[model samples]
Target: MRLENQIAIVTGSGGAGGIGEAIARRFVSEGAKVVVCDIDEEKAQAVAGALGPNATPWACDVSRSDQVEAMVAGVVPMFGRLDILVNNVGFTVPGFLRDLGDEAWHHVLNGCLSSTFYGIRAALKPMREQKSGSIINISSAAGIGGAPGLGAYGAAKAGVVSLTQTAAVENFKSGVRVNCVLPNAATKSLTAWFDATESGRKTRAAIEAYSRCGSPEEIAAAVLFLASDDSAYVNGTVLPVDGGLSSRVACIDATIE
Candidate 1:
């Protein structure tokens, strides 16, 4: 019960295949009263129901400022206090930068990047006043480096990492810690996306082989660490739970010929 009686909101926690859902369940297990918010109403309710009394569901689009505000305002009355905010709503498209359409570029940016800004802005009022809170943004390993088809996605995620660090420093005095996590989990969405593309299929297999492809549980563990007091002194870090992939390198010339 590390988070006993704590109040937490996990955005975009509808799908069984998303990081948001995984974080919600993990928070519940840690004794937090979890508020599951998503654009998918039914799916959100279903997950909330499964988590029992401590979980509540709300339909919200993190991209919308009004919806984000309503979600936080509603949660405070329902749960009495807000201690943690996990920004996990994100989407991606696989295509080269030159081939990507304007709509696709904006969609990727809105979902992966703008949403994080909205969530943090909405949560800051309460957290600042209370003088204690933890905000964890779900970034990706692709954000840490350049990728073939993730032009927009990589850009957005990288912004999330930068946002996390800046917010942490700005809010340090208020006791609000902002941290980002670069998780390399093999969720269903990723698998299906890879299955549809040749290069994706090959890259996915290679990634799985080298990293063993982490489970949602593993990512959730790192998240809980940041959420709990164990990481009180830790802030503004882009912690990669990616099986050493973040620090790895491939040598092109194996021999010193």
Candidate 2:
């Protein structure tokens, strides 16, 4: 019950198996009322229905600032107040930089970076007013260390990290804590890319060599830590929930020069 009576909004939670859904479920289990938002109305409703009365479904295209602002504006009226926001809406289009077109690049950047910007911008007013809030942006190991074929994704996610730090610094004194989680979980998104490319195979092997592959639940646990009072002193930091993968270099050559 760490989040007892708190109200939270988790974006991009409508997919069949997404990290956002896991975070929403975890929040509910901790006694928080959650708004499960997604671009797909049906999927959002399904997740909310499964989470019972503690969760409500909202349809929103987070890449659009108007929709995001409206979503945040509606939260307090429905739930009484906003206490937590998990900006978890993002997807990757795996391809080398040369192979990716401008359309693809903008798509990834808008989805991963602009969406986060929209979420934080919209959530800040309410959070600042309350004088207490937590904003957890979902980042990726690729964002930190770079991935061979995930150029656009890595760049966009890296932007998320920078955005989180800036937001945290600007809002900490106002009582709104902003942080990020670089998750290295084996989700459908990662698995799809892994099954499709040689670079993906190598990346997965490297991750396995460093640590056990993580699950959505494990990532959800980390999100809980950031979202709850447990991480009260934490802000403007990038917490890698990647099973120690971020702690070491992924290079295979280990011989001493």
Candidate 3:
């Protein structure tokens, strides 16, 4: 068991078919005790119940630093130690920059970027004391390369990549590793966009042309690899589990026309 006897926390894991839930299940299957943290109490409880003895539910609004800190503090006492943290709580309101509101920008940054910052800051205390821990942050291919309608989201996710690198360098001497995964999966957000907009359709087609779209489980595999000792030498890296979608140049030749 790669994570045997380890204790892990996965935020935003309450959604029925989301990546966070998948990661929690995968960790439990690998013999790790998981804390399913979500803003929705009922949903978090439901997922934790389904995972049986290996999981516990914690209601937390991760964007709130106080709540995040409390969650981390509580977990260490309950589990005796914290071995892993997956900052998976994030969402985006897709819109062009000109059409996006100030509130929308704040929402994206708070949910996607600020929440991750809070999680990492809270986890660092326990992790540094243990002198051995792994933190896996979820980023996006949109972050690596700009997306037309997802500018705010892409920007926030890009911040995640920067934070991951900085945190890795800061904690490496303490035996803690920080890395991030840029996943291109058919998530609820993507599916909703695809159903509502023509641009979404084009984006999906382009992604599929580059590489077949993936599932939450496939993304979970990459997270697990980083969370385990198998990736001891890996840190401060942005691993794109995007089925090669992020490896190509999507721009057209300006001189062709």
- TM-score for each predicted model, relative to the true structure: 0.94, 0.94, 0.95
40, model 3: CA deviation in Å?
0.6
Residues forming the 10-long window of minimal summed lDDT in candidate 2: 248-257
Q: Please give the range of 10 consecutive residues that has the lowest summed lDDT in model 3.
A: 248-257
lDDT of 2 at 108: 94
Answer with 2 or 3, whichever has the higher lDDT.
3
Q: Which candidate wins on TM-score?
A: 3
Backbone clashes under 3 angstroms, per model: 0, 0, 0
Across residues 1-257, which tens digit of lDDT does each residue of candidate 3 receive? 99999999999998878999999999999999999999999999999999999999999999899999999999999999999999999889979999999999999999999999999999999999989999999999888997888989999999999999999998878999999999986577666776588877876777676677788999999999999999999999999998887887767425564
lDDT of each: 0.88, 0.90, 0.92
Write the number of the candidate with greater lDDT, choosing between 1 and 3: 3
Clashing residue pairs in candidate 2 are: none
Q: State residue 197's C-alpha deviation in candidate 2, in Å.
A: 5.4
lDDT of 1 by residue, 132-234 (tens): 9999999999899997888999999999999999999888789899999998754877767678889768877877656757777788889999999999999
- lDDT tens digits by residue: candidate 2, 102-126: 9989999999999999999989998
Clashing pairs in 3: none
Off by over 4 Å in 1: 192-197, 251-257
List where candidate 3 sits over 4 angstroms from the true fold. 192-196, 252-257
Ranking by lDDT: 3, 2, 1
Alpha-carbon error at 190 in model 2, in Å? Answer: 2.8
What does candidate 2 score on TM? 0.94
